[model samples]
Each structure stands twice: as C-alpha cells, then as structure tokens.
Target: MTKLLLGRYLPGDSWVHRLDPRTKLMASFYYIGIIFLANNWQSYLLMFVATMVMVALSKIKLGFFLRGVRPMIWLILFTVALQIFFTKGGTVYWSWGWLAITQYGLTNGAFIFMRFVLIIFVSTLLTLTTQPLSLADAVESLLKPLRRIGVPVTELALVLQIALRFVPTLMDQTTKIMNAQRARGVDFGSGNLFQQMKAVVPLLIPLFVDSFGIAEDLATAMDARGYQGGDGRTKFRILQYHQPDIVAGLAMVLLTVGLVFLRA
Candidate 1:
C-alpha cells in the first residue's frame, strides 16, 4: 500500500532551492554523465563525497533521501547478483556448479549499484526542491530554440507539466483505492504472486476510470477558459537567471572537470 514511487518534496530555503530550474536540470545531466564516466573506486569515492556535500547544502533531511532510495534497493541487489554471477574476469571467490562469483564481478556489481543509487538520489533531490510548474517553465524556456525546427515546444511543456502534476494526484488516488479495497476484505499481500497480481485488477479498473474522468474534467475546464495552445501565450511571472544561478552553473562545470580529471 505504500507508494514509494511518489517521492515527497521537502520545502527548504537552501541554495539548491534558490537555483533556477534550468540550471538545476543542466547540472543534473552533467552530474549523471560524470557518474557514468567514473571508472574506478577513487573517482567514485570523489563523486560520492561531492554528492554528499550537495545533499548537505540542500538542507533536506537525510532520512527523506534514504527513504526515496528504499524502493530501488531490490533493483540494486538484483544488479549486484547478476554482475557477481556473470562477470568472468579476476579471481573466483565462489563456485557452485554453474554459478560462479569472481572478484571482478563483485567489484563491477558494487560500482554499478552505487552508480545507480547516486544517479537516482541526485535526480530525486532536484525534483524534491523544484516546483512542477517551475520545471515546466524551465523546460519550455530551454527548448524554445526547438520551435525553429517546427517542434511544438509549448505542447511538449504542457505534457511535461501535466505529467508532473498528475503524479502526486495519481498516488493519492491509488492510496485511496487501496484503502477502500482493504476495507472490503481485499488483501493485496496475502496471496501468491499470480493471485496478488489478480488482486490488482480491481484496483486498476477504478484507477483507469478515474484517470479518464479527471482528464475529461480538465479538458472541459480548459475549454471553458478559452484556452489556446502556443499562440502568443503571455506569462505574468518571467523566469530570470541571476548571479546565484551563474555561480551554480560554474560550480557544476568545475565538478564535471574535476570528476573527469580524477578518472583520467
């Protein structure tokens, strides 16, 4: 019943929260690139240290960050197992019939697991501090040049905005539906894998029905307001990149360079 995918946004007055969404988005991309470019334990350790500093600066609780990672533990474990059993280089640590564990595999698995965890943690932190509307605005502004290529940047932004906005709402609805089913003697966790999946059928039906209903209502509301797409739409609040954003951008660039140099 716990919706782990719906990570909670913790409001804070930290430097990260003050950053322009566009800057944060670009930084996130650079950070992920650095994470993947890291090839050894030393570079990975440095990246981890840098990420921890960013986390501390964000002022969001460490507990929240760990909680956001809980859902991914199984996936991390699975990757670890796959790498440990399949990677054939280095000294063999264990051998049992067809299954083998090699030192190289273990190291590779651990690195990959940590890499995925850091990527998720850092990206989720960005989302935690950013408002969905602000993200939409930032994305729209960033993609404005695509308009020259006949791409509908405004429509793309609207879709991203709606998707972000609906995430929390959908999570809430799922919780409500699960609780209602629980009250009606439906047990989601008390059955075989197949049976448990079957239990979700009832939940899925209502979820879809309500999703369509909400979409219809939203369309009606927009239509009532004479809403038109991408046609001279004016914003009351314009996004501005300030000095702090510039500093953050520079820091991200430096971080990227440091990470690459450390790897080399």
Candidate 2:
C-alpha cells in the first residue's frame, strides 16, 4: 500500500511533468475512453505503444508505474479469469459443464487485461506527474461551465484534491498502525485468509479513530484561518498552456485517429 503511487505525486522536470494539468487530466480520461474502441490485436498494440511512449516521456522509472498496478493485480486477474471462463465464442479449447475455454474467450481475456493495465498506467502517469492541487485547478477550470447551472465546481475540485492528497497520508497512517500493532504481537502476514482479515480488525479501529481526529483537526485549522468557500476566491497559481500541452493534445488526436483506423 505504501509503495502504491496512484494518487501520489513525484516531483520532476520531465516533459510530461511540465504539461498543463488540464492537458494531462483530459488526455488521461480521453485515452481511457478510446481504449474501448480497441477490439483486436492491432488496435491494442497501437494503444499499448502509445501508452508506453507517454510513460517513457514522463521519465519516471517503469518500476514505479508497475508498483501502481501491483496492488490491483489480484482484482485484475480475477476479472480477466472471469472473462476467460464465462465468455463463450470462437473455438472451444476446453469444456466442462457450464464452464468452457474458447478462442474468443482467450482473446477477450487478453484484451481485458491490456485494457486494465493501459488504463492504470495512464492514470498513474497523470497522478505521478501532476500535483494534486494542479489537478484540482484543471478539474475546476474544465468544469467551470457547470457553475452556470448552480453546480459547486470549486467545492467539488477541493474535494478531489483533498482525496488525492490524503491517499498518501492514509497509506502512511496504515503503515504506522500496522507497525504499532506488530510491536504488540499482531501478525499480519503469517495467517490464513480469514485469520489475516480478523487480524486487520485491530488495525482498522485505531486507524479510523486517528483518521477522524485528523479530519477534525484539519477542519478546525480551516475554520481558524477564516477559510470560506471558493466563491470569489483567487488562485495562488494560474494554469497556462504551452508548447508541450499543444503537442500532447495533438498526440492524443493522432492516437485517436489511429485507434479508429485500427479498430476491428
């Protein structure tokens, strides 16, 4: 959990690091949506290459991006396995009662796995390269038009940034809780599945208490600082587009066209 980097930012001066938050944020979402357009190996390969290129541009180690996927590995495999076993089409490689492995099932399973990895990699790239606060600004800017309909865009953005920022904090807190419990003779790793879950109960209670206390303290600090809601508030930093953002936008456009062309 501590090694997970999904919501954590790493400061760098790479090309990807310098992209406008709006570009990165929108591109991440846009890439995810276009992933569904991939139906065959050609399209998947193209998307995979594009994703890897973006990762390479970020100049972060591939291992860090991989760590982001590690925590979700089980879930990904379970889902891919379900798709393989339950989905039926093409040639039947094996069959037993209601379960069957077919050619189409294998293909679809591979596609699903690729989809999951690609999405996670892209998302991890966004969070790693862009600060949470910058993401909040991008989200607020993009959703500003919704303010006309009385939507609370500023508050929503604040919530998003806070959630992102707290992920690392909560992870660190979990690590501390585990360590403290371990010192008192709680074994987290040496047990069966049910036993491990039962052991986690001791960890969660205190963690929740601490989390609530932290939240309360934060709220008090905000109150003490006379922090009002985001209406008529000014930003300390303004987001601006640059050549890199334009390049990124164009890259996304080209990737979209390629995927459309390559989709089976």
Candidate 3:
C-alpha cells in the first residue's frame, strides 16, 4: 500500500515538475487519447520513446515510475494474457483445447501491455509532479465554465483535493492497523478465500472507525479555520502557461500527427 504512488505528490524542481498543473493535467489526457491512435509497432515505439523522454525530463528516477506500475503488474499481465489467448486472427502458432496463440494475438497482447504501461506512467508522472492543491485548482479552472450551468465546481474540486490528500494517509493507517491486528494474532494472509475475508472484518472495523475519527477532526479543523466553502475565495498563487508549456503542447501535436501517419 505504501508503494501506491498514484495520489501522492513528490516535490521537485525538474522541467516536468515546473509546468503549470493545468498543462500537465491536459497533456496527460492528450497522451492517453493519442496512444490509442498507435496501431503498429513503429507507432508504439515512437510513443514509447516520447513517454521515456518525458520521464527523463521529470528527473525522477525511472524506478519510481516503475514502482507505480508494479502494483498493476498482475492486472496488466492478466489483460495481456487474455488478449494473447483469446484474440483470433493471423497465423496460429500454438493451440490448446480452447485457447490458441496466433500472430495477431501476440501483436495485440504486446500492444495492450504497452498501452497499460504508457498510461500508468503518464498518470503517475502527473500525480507525482503536481501538488494536490494545484491539481484541484486545475480541475476547478477547467470546470469553471460549467459554473454558469449551476455546477458546484468549487465544492467538487475541494472534494477531489481532499480525496487525493487522504489516500496516503489512509494507506499508512491501514498498514498500522494491519500490524496491530497481526500482533493480536489475526492472520490476514493465512486462509482460504472465505476465511481470509472473515479475518479481514476485524481489520476493517478499526480502519473505518479511525477513518471517521480522522474525518471528524479534519472537519473541526476546517470549521475552526472558517473554511466556509469556496465562495469568495481567491487563490494565493495563479496558474500561468510559460514557454515550456507551449513547447510541450507543440511536441504533443507533433507526436499526434506522427502517430496518425505511422499507424497501420
């Protein structure tokens, strides 16, 4: 759980870290969309290279991004395996009762694997580089135009920010609770499926209790500090696009255009 890096922010002054949060947020979305445009190995290779270059610019070690992928490794492998075994087309290379590995299956499985890694890597980069507050600001800014339609964008953004902030805290709390339960002879790891679930009840009860207590304390603190919703609130720091943001946008455009021409 501690290895979960999706919602946690790592402070840095690297090029990727210095961009406006809004830019990073939009770029991540753009990359995800363009990634699907890649159909051939050449297109995927180009995307892979572009993604790695972004990682390099972030200046965070590749290992941290990889660690983010580790938690999803099972999921990635399962999806890839499904594609490899279930997808039918092209030359059949091997066969078992109802499953067969074919050229198309192998190709599709590789593509799926690359897609999973690239998406996860880009998303992890966004969260690792952008502060929760900045992300909320970006969200709120992007959604601001919807306010005329009566959408509560401010409240929604605040909720998102709080959720992101709480993920790490909750993970740590869960870890501590697990250790305490272990000390009390509650074996979380040893058991059949049903038995494991039964063992988890004790762990969950305390976690829920603690979570509520934490929420109550936060509410009290917010009330004491007079955080009466986002009405009339002004940001201490404003988001502004710079030269790097423009360059980054241009690079994305080029990548998108390249994928269109290169994809089969």
Q: Which of the numbered candidates is closest to the native, going by highest lDDT?
A: 3
RMSD of 1: 4.0
Q: What is the lDDT of candidate 3?
A: 0.92
Q: Is candidate 2 or candidate 3 better by lDDT?
A: 3
Per-residue lDDT of candidate 3, residues 1-264 (tens digit): 554445467889999999999999999999998899999999999999999999999999988899889989999999999999999999999999999999999999999999999999999999999987888889899889999899999889888878878887998898899999899999998879999999999989999999899999999999999899888887776789999999999999999999999998
Ranking by TM-score: 3, 1, 2
Provide the global lDDT of candidate 2 against the true structure: 0.91
Q: Candidate 3, TM-score vs. the true structure?
A: 0.78
- Candidate 3's clash total is 0
| TM-scores of all candidate predictions against the true structure | 0.77, 0.76, 0.78
lDDT of 2 by residue, 130-151 (tens): 8878888998999999999999
C-alpha lDDT (0 to 100) for residue 78 of candidate 1: 91
Better of 1 and 2 by TM-score: 1
Q: Write the per-residue lDDT of candidate 1 for residues 1-264, one digit (tens) a residue.
A: 223433455677899999889998888988897788887888899889888988998998788778768889998889889988998888998899988999899889989988988998898888889876887898899999999999999888877878877887888899899999989988897778999998998899999999999999999998898878876888775788999899988887787787788885
Full-model lDDT for every candidate: 0.85, 0.91, 0.92
Query: How good is model 2 by TM-score?
Result: 0.76
Cα deviation of 69 in candidate 3 (Å)? 1.4
* Pairs with backbone N, CA or C atoms under 3 Å apart (clashes), candidate 1: none
The regions of model 1 sitting more than 4 angstroms off are 1-7, 159-226
